[model samples]
Target chain A: MTEAQEKNIPDVSSDFEPKIVAFCCHYCSYAAADLAGSMRLDYPTNIKILKIPCTGKVDVLYLLRAFEDGADGVIVAGCEEGTCHFINGNIKAKKKVKYTKKILDDIGLGGDRLEMYNLSAAMGQKFADLAKEMTERIKKLGPSPVNSGA
Target chain B: MIVGEQKPIEEISKMIAEYKTVLVMGCNTCIAVCHAGGEKEVGILASALRIKNKVEGREQNIEEASMERQCEREFVDELADKIKEADCVLSLACGVGPQTIVEFYPDTIVLPGINTTFYGMPKEQGFFVEFCGGCGNCVLDMTAGICPIVRCSKSMLNGPCGGSQEGRCEVNKDIDCGWQLIHDRLKAQGKLDFMDEILPPKDWSPARHGGPRKMVREDLKIDEKPEDEIEGITKEGEK
Candidate 1:
């Protein structure tokens, strides 16, 4: 940290901790998370993973509720294209995520807070990389405005 | 069924901005089936409105209620008590629901949350196509059950318009030429001879051109006196 920049950091920002929610599909992204753990790969601890049958099961309501409940960011992780165990669950999820992004933008949460990522069960390193990437993006964006005190 | 869609959230929010207490009323019948205004949709909208209010730092109270059919008086009566508590009612039913609520509660402000697009059935899941014009005339027998008044872009009665190209509508490439569909249907039934028959000009008096239409059945009308009042003398004679 630069000496001048480090000295001016507000106490609130120094203590600011982002809360991220991940909706992971059981057949792919969830298993990938498991693989990441088995490999002892490091990922941000702020991310809370919720295991779902498929990313298609992630309702727009659920994503909205996460933000309403003070989530700083949300990630819907599903199987890669053409490899969804449920035929097209991941494909459907991508559409839902795109739709939810519009809603977020409409409601002033800035859309960037929600994203959809796809990975295979064997991509442990990719999962770790996404976790760190999402965390940094959210940290730069700061806490969700939806969670800001009214 | 009546097909309608929810108004954009921005539009709805702007409507209820001045009101502190807003009630979102949903209809369980037509709008529900169309995925527009239903119980679940009401909840979603109510939440969205609350979130919008929070983001804007506006103190607002939003409530939700759903009725079986918003067009009927009895079903609308169910919201009587709740209606009194609200400053404005945001009706999520088709256009009829808001009108019904307005008639029942003339003093209250009732807002429309949907634009009633058409009287149609679900062509497929999440898709609706207009099929009936309610022109107060029935000519399905002559057209093999197709109503050209609704299906045809030009409402052509006799035959396909020359503008039709390859069985597709000239106006919209995605739309099938309504006359082409009629021709295929009539051909399948071996009723191609009907194609040569000339149809008379349609009488549009029963349509909206005659202003709002009302159908009254004399047999269905009740007498001025109740059944008990009329039958009282007969019951005494029997006794």
Candidate 2:
């Protein structure tokens, strides 16, 4: 495996730290991430979490802005399917993610850089695992095209 | 209300190429309600045009302004000073506004920044459906208030034509069959018998067939003053 790929693995020591923006729904994913921290679970500190009232509140424009502002990758963490506290908020988030993926692909950013993950508030460990997984995935993809110049 | 959308960015950019100073005009009437040519849209379009022009390395002086109603002569007349400063005007209003600008400023180049669609009503937050043809005839009483002329795929007065299948139009599966909706609505209201009456061939002359139509009211007429007499008149007297 390449040095970059090896650096991406969870718990593996390396100097590389991917800048990730996690848009967590307040009802579920935000609480889960907090729980993971309280549980003393070790996860990459590279991710910056932005808590929103609902996942549906994350607009496509926000996703594009994140990338434009030098986020290597973006992960929208919402409530598990059919479990959104705000009714169909998570479903709407999923639709926005799908739409944003298409737009990212069109703009030559590679849609895989953005992802939508669902987890209940109780799944604290899973949230950490997702963070590790996405960070490593983004590490392998290298810095975002927008950030490459800087 | 008239529904319209802004012309493509490239097209608008090309139209304003020759002019060093351009005014982006918006209409705050029907197009505004439909969320097409409103003040907000004017700002968005202006920003986009400015950015696109800058990116293309062709810098032009562009200004933004909007009026309450562009189709009215009085409202358009208010833009005399702004129009005088601008070499060209890019009207964000529907077709009528651009024509009105042309009528007012014969020497100024009037360009349309929007493609006028049709008279429509807001179906939902962001969706507008064409609902009127401006046929100069009122047939809503007979059609249960549904305008088949505008909503129907074929504009058939007596329809649910052979192409209608499963309550949808054959041309577009997404479109609900206008006749099917009309029939169901009329049946629910116990007015299905009205369908049996054949609609007469609509008179096209009242709409577009005849030369331009006009409505004149003698009561609304203002007596023209002789040039010598008007020299003594003030702004208050004109009203």
Candidate 3:
């Protein structure tokens, strides 16, 4: 945690809704989210999914923009390692997400607010579970500290 | 190419703490190629600053702009209007970029957002190695292309020092012995005889010891400050 965020961790309300931004890769996590919808799997509606051609296209700029724009949490969803649509898009994305996490940590937003998860098209259950897990995690972390200033 | 890395966010934030409006400038050339200061990096740094300001409760007006090259006068001139409006310019270019900006807009406050690291090339993705020391002398032909000045820890010109062991430098085993590399390359090219020449000591005067150096080509001169207004131009051969 940065000095800016060391002041205090305020208690979140019982009905706090986290604004989660999910950058889902088209070949895998997007398909997983679609299948999750088709299977009638109940997940947090707070996860706003934005589809991209591949996770490699996810730049550090995109991740920072999410927090700057009031996202309580950010998720980078890509294909399972070594199973990328563009050979190594997920690998690049994984590294980028890790780098962005450090940047987020530097800004006192706490790296916990950002995460990267690998998924496959068939694993709808995993998608729903990860979303739930992320939502719960963010709920514990409360709203992003950046939002406090806004 | 000149490589650089961005400074810590805290340091950068502190630099602009006194200013309200900032123009985040970037160059799309060498620094960009090394993933330091480019257009994409401009966005990243600008966004990070915005986030930091918001998180720290600082009301700042930050804008971002990138040029083809910040080392050039024409490109640096294009950002004049933006530089004029901002309280200061945060440059995401190598050291030369900020200096160039100051040379042109003397009144504008310019700060370096990246530290100029070295003259090197990337060995692989996300990996870079220092290749040249820019010592103002060319000894590559005799050294079989391996730069003893930079590749060698001691910058030895003759041969490897006693610290060299197993084809590695004593400074670090990860670093290959520059002389050893030169030996192997020379042997392969049937130029091993050059190693036995026992070359004389290098002329340090031509290097940095001679102070700042400048080169001018008479034929390349396009600007006119009046041929007789040769205050700084030194006569080469009186031609």
Model 1 TM-score relative to the real fold: 0.88
TM-score of 2: 0.64
Q: For candidate 2, lDDT tens digit of each residue in A58-88? A: 9776776677577889999999988888889
Docking class of 1: acceptable
DockQ comparisons of all candidates to the true complex:
0.45, 0.08, 0.67
List the global CA lDDT of all models.
Answer: 0.86, 0.81, 0.89
Which segments of candidate 3 are over 4 A away from where they belong? A1-7, B224-239
Off by over 4 Å in 2: A1-17, A148-150, B1-129, B158-175, B190-193, B206-239
**Candidates 2 and 3, the one with greater TM-score:** 3
In terms of TM-score, which candidate is strongest?
A: 3
lDDT of 2 by residue, B1-239 (tens): 89998777667878899888898999999888976687877765665555445435565777888999999868877877787799999999999998877765677788998899998888897798888988787688888888888778998888879999999999999999988888888999999998998898877788867877766565765866654464344322232
Worst 10 residues of 2 chain A by lDDT: A4-13
- Over B201-224, each residue of candidate 3 has an lDDT whose tens digit, in order, gives 888777878997667687888876
**DockQ for model 2?**
0.08
Number of clashing residue pairs in every model?
0, 0, 0
